[model samples]
Target: MDFATPRRRRPAEAIVPMINVVFLLLIFFLMSAQITPPAPFDVTLPESENDNAARPADTLYMDAQGQLAFNTARGEAVYDAIAARAAPDTPLQIRADARLEAQALARFLPELAARGIAEIELLTGMP
Candidate 1:
């Protein structure tokens, strides 16, 4: 007859706790992150001497070649989209390539005004 008691195995660790922590971390990051749509095309913003910091909204993109994009719309269609979305009081931001011609931009401004866009802001990078 055996006098000694049999040894018991240790219980397995719980993976549920780790999974819960991982899910919690995921939730935190998702909530904290600011998600914005990428620019329709690459743009190299002009530099400015002013230190003014402004957040972009209802943005229009202009390439060096004078290509226009607003949200998913491109070229002439961009104007219609902008006209539909913009309120007379709401400001529109333009992210134009530094290499874009000033005359091209100047020509474009009247079109925006014709579309009833009153307030406009040009977004530029800091030197």
Candidate 2:
């Protein structure tokens, strides 16, 4: 003739195992993820100590002689070609030689800006 109330049972799930799994996944991603540098055309670029900057795919190159190139093609032809292919919002990267004067950049940037390209990045390598 007993009439005592039944006891409640707690959930058997443990957060420790879940936390361990999360940590393992984090470590796996950290180890598996690879970082690769962007390959622009062959050009001698300016050197800098900062190497953690992100690069854009669309690059404009200026050689030591102040000759311009987009990718591999040289001179104004490449500039026109790039202008035709690139969108207004294309991220433009400039890889100019250290000896290349600022006047070269100044001349082209205005036209690039006029074409609705506002985002410009200067490429530099680790010294």
Candidate 3:
């Protein structure tokens, strides 16, 4: 009787190392990501045909009740904060609630101009 040679088995790939690498990548992305702060109040933006995407920089918020907020500043204090932060030429973005009056916005513009905000962009949502 001839002696049979023992069969050799190949080792399986190490899934544990792959899993560790994936976890490390997830951790890195979570740490490196920039998280945007929530808006101070809810705003229902007006619908428009415009498809423009707004930059997150230099934004002012106005609610349906005509209350204004800019960063940590609120109410009339927001004007002072905006004046301090805005340059004469840089356009400020206004995120106004849909329910806010056009007349109110008209009045608000002069206040901004008095504070030296010469230009502004009104943000709107797709209909």
Candidate 4:
């Protein structure tokens, strides 16, 4: 009887199910991520078709009672706090109620201007 060498068997291919699962998980996370807006106050900003630019770095708000509020803080002394917190170069966004008096706004604007605030934007409701 003649003796012959045994045939060598090739190893099986690696499983790809784990790779597919990882890819699916990545896609799920990407889709479920939340993108939040960068406003400190809950004021309903009036929208404009011409406003496709990014939001300003700082915000000031005047409520119905002619009271001023800054960012996330609530008080009448917000002007000084806002001036302290804002950068010298960043523009300030002002949101005032429709019924607010012009005299009150006039009184506070100069104070902001004196504090090295350059650009001031008045937010108005959409007509």
Candidate 5:
């Protein structure tokens, strides 16, 4: 006659603990991730002596090639598009090339001002 005792059955509760841990980790990562707005182009901004304040959420760019873009989207007239999207309360940041002509910069200022974009922020790299 066999004298071996009947094998005890293990509880099926292990899966429940693993599932809970996985869900907790997923929630943590989602909360920590940051979402940023896209840019129209890739241009190296000129550095400034004073680099105060953080970068703005809304940015408009003008590259050295005289191309106008918004939030990394090229082939668009920046002034009109930015004016349309901008409101008096929300300021628009301009990241223009240092080598860009003064006349060109001068021309756009009035357009931006006329649209009630009072708070203008210029972005520059760290010197």
Candidate 6:
């Protein structure tokens, strides 16, 4: 009787390792990428003839109804709300509606200066 050695079969390549690698790359990219800034709420930024490309600071939203909302909250006193969250050195950005009255602006602009915010930027859409 002749004796022959049986050949062992090789296992197929696994996709698990590839999937793990893909997931790891995705995680790495997500971690390394810059995080999006928080808007907290949505505002329809006003339109302007002149616009600058400079990156502005945290935004303040003012509705057409003369209501002040730092992002989304409708507070009793806008100054108090601002003072509670923002520091003296924090940059200020204002996003106000086109219908915002001058009196309303006068009420808060001086207060912002008094609070020691060095510069403030008003964001608007390009016309």
Residue 6 C-alpha lDDT in model 4: 83
lDDT of 6 by residue, 5-38 (tens): 8866555346677889999999999999977566
Deviation (Å) of 54 in candidate 6? 4.8
Model 4: weakest 10-residue lDDT segment is 36-45
Query: What is candidate 4's lDDT per residue for 42-108, written digit by digit as tens?
Result: 4555555564465755667776566767766667567667768847567787887666677987887
The residue pairs found clashing in candidate 1 are none
Candidate 1: where are CA atoms >4 Å away? 1-19, 86-88
Using lDDT, rank the candidates from best to worst: 1, 3, 2, 5, 6, 4
Instruction: Mark the 10 consecutive residues where model 6 has the least summed lDDT.
Output: 7-16
Q: Candidate 3: lDDT of 17? A: 75
Could you tell me the lDDT of residue 85 within candidate 2? Answer: 60
Compose the digit string of candidate 5's lDDT tens values, residues 15-114.
7888999999999999988877655556777877885866545677877766677754555466657766745477788788877786887777887787
Against the correct fold, how does model 4 do in TM-score? 0.57
Query: Which structure is stronger by lDDT: 1 or 3?
Result: 1
**lDDT, candidate 3, 1-127, per-residue tens:** 8689876654544567788899999999999997887899999999999798987677899999999998899998998899889454678999999999999999999998888888899999999
Candidate 2, residues 1-127, lDDT tens digits: the string is 8788886555545567788999999999999987545444457778888867864467777877777777566777865667676454667878888888888778878887766677888888888
TM-score of each: 0.80, 0.58, 0.81, 0.57, 0.65, 0.63
Of models 4 and 6, which has the larger TM-score? 6
lDDT of each: 0.90, 0.74, 0.89, 0.70, 0.74, 0.71
Native-to-model Cα distance after best TM-score fit, residue 12 in candidate 4, in Å: 26
Off by over 4 Å in 3: 1-13, 86-89
User: Residue 102 of candidate 4: its Cα lDDT?
Assistant: 77
Candidate 4 residue pairs in backbone clash: none
